[model samples]
Target: MSKTSQDEWTLEIKPVSGWFHFHLKDVWRYRDLLMMFVRRDFVAVYKQTILGPFWFFLQPILTTITFTVVFGNIARISTDGIPPLLFYMSGIVSWGYFSDCLTRTSSTFITNANIFGKVYFPRLVSPLSNIISLLMKFGIQLFLFTCFLLYYWMNGSTNVHPNIYILLTPYLLILMAGLGLGFGIIVSSLTTKYRDFSFLVGFGVQLLMYATPVIYPLSALPEKYKWIVLANPMTAIIDTFRYAFLGAGTFNPGNLIYSSVFMIVTLSIGILMFNRVEKTFMDTV
Candidate 1:
């Protein structure tokens, strides 16, 4: 028997670890595919849309407006005397980024199984590229948030001025990426065996936003429920973001430690499981 050209060429993907465990070189080799995927995500996502990237900006804008109207003006949720717009926007900015990552990461397996089955690249490439694409979207939305931030900053809202914590903004970005990827990989791995995950992801993320402090402050939570709410790693991430932007939030050092530990543990597990799944997931998925 003679093998054809496609058959003769082998997929030589292998897993590596340490700081370089992700096989950066192999991922770099697939950079074109990564760029194509990013373009596909950007264009295909809103292909029929009139607004295009503006819609990305609008999502958090509309959300902050509704929350300002419903939860802020109507419900009179406390914002520590900061403008209702600023308070809600901070939460919206962080939540939008975190949730976007979470949703995108969660679908990595089911959404791209066809690509994985046909080709061999660093499996991490898919999620990593997705993360980069997501960051682009987040950057757009953050610009929208910044407009409001500047407005309030000029109005002297809440005695808030950007402070030392603001310097940790990059860490907050990494925190959002790590948490989303970690949680998403776990969900994607499970969904391979039990397909209930796809359903859960939609409703679950909505519920999680309320469960988090996206529209409300951690200061307003009932004493007992505060612990449960802050237990979410997004809690620290969001709080830190708000603290950085508005100079006010419930960002305890202990909470940051909790989130850091949780993210590290979950990300390690995610990589281990994803590596294991890359070998066999297509069989089940």
Candidate 2:
């Protein structure tokens, strides 16, 4: 081939040396592949299911009812004067998105090994696609929550008070997505070497939810125990989300700042480790 043709045909593969090096530009170049993966994830999940996407609505509603009965009535946990249904739904929807992203993305390496070995694309694309797919599900559940909010509003319930803080919803989601994607890719990378870690992800996420302020308001916790929950990066996001929509729970700017910093650090580390693992994961996986 001529010099120009040879240059056009040449493909260079370089070893990743430094910890901080990431080809984000390359990932952006393959955005079409990312979208394809997202479509596949969204469609494949509901393809054979009877209810299809309706399951998204059903899952949260049923869980809310169960929580209202068990936690609200049985345990008598305070909802900070907000209605029990709205209180639990707010926490549920936020927690559900974060958990779904974490759990699904954590298995990217193992689940997509066949494709990874067969073709070349940004390995991060799989997990990123999972995050996008979960966002879609979160939107549907959020709509359901809004419907309930409107119902309570029309009923003239003075207890349910939404405020300007509700504007933080987008930022809250970005934080959650960062945390989930960060923690998830880290776990996914580790699991390739030790399969035992896979079993713990589900159990660990369940335990982590209780550690977050999902079932009860953060304000209800005694002062001594408050710091323990605050240590979790998710606690602040969930607390602020509840406070914004329902006008209940602690809304500390300091906590939100801490959570944001934690997310950035975790995501940076996660991407670093993910880059290292992707180079050799196929061999061990």
Candidate 3:
């Protein structure tokens, strides 16, 4: 066969994927829609709220105060020798970013069934936009955390200083985004098949949080449960958050690497499944 004939006769075949079938270039072509969805999320979130985005700052502040009193003052849990407010806030801010992302992204398919059915933009854009919107909230919470950090640095016993490992902050944020998006996509995909999953998302995420290392330090866990705790990737993420700001954490760099690998695996798998499901989800969903 000549080169021209081979080119002209090339057969079209359905795609098969082992893991990732990233449509990065295709996603780029739809970047405008991504921004539109992001704006839509932000605008719709506080369309009629009294305090608007200001509520973002209030939520985490009140949460940290409550946790500090109830868990630290009342329950007397250790903070690895760091101040209670700072310790809990570090965990809260990061966990809030992740859990909030998961909660919102979990609604990706069901929430946008009409849009997905009507439109042709990349479905990944929906969750990606929601994560960006969630990141704005995370940034606000982090600003509050920084203020608390400065307060402790000025007057509290907290030798508030970040380690060289603090440079991993961006990677940590990416890990959080990846885990939320990846896990949420998987759940959304299942929800299409099993109606029970809609209820499970909220309940499951709550129960899952207990397994994560948010309320207490990883060291506080019993030796037997250590493996179970570390098995949760959020454990590494939470500990790394503490390690970055308060220097009161014992995160292994190796574990962080493991978490990074796990996050990439999760996101890649999620994207692949989501792409597959979106094609036929309308009938089932």
Tens-place lDDT digits, model 2, residues 150-250:
99999998998889999999999999999999999999999999988788898999999999999998878899988889899999999999989988877
Off by over 4 Å in 3: 1-22
Give all candidates' CA lDDT scores. 0.82, 0.93, 0.84
Write the residue-wise lDDT of candidate 1 on 1-285 in tens digits: 465666666665445333324455777888998898888777788887898777887888888899999998899988876788888988888788888888888888898888888987777778877888988888887888788788877876656766778778888899889988998888888888788987898899999988888888788889989878977888888888888888776668888889989999999888777777767787899
- Candidate 3, residue 188: CA error in Å? 1.0
Q: Which one is best on lDDT? A: 2
Cα deviation of 79 in candidate 3 (Å)?
A: 1.1
Q: What TM-score do all the candidates reach, one by one?
A: 0.87, 0.95, 0.91
Clash tally, candidates in order = 2, 0, 0
Ten contiguous residues minimizing lDDT sum, candidate 1: 13-22
- The global Cα lDDT (0 to 1) of model 2 is 0.93
Candidate 2 vs candidate 3, TM-score winner: 2
Once superposed on the true structure, which residue ranges of model 2 sit more than 4 Å away at CA?
1-10, 14-16
Distance from true position, residue 194, model 1, in Å? 1.3
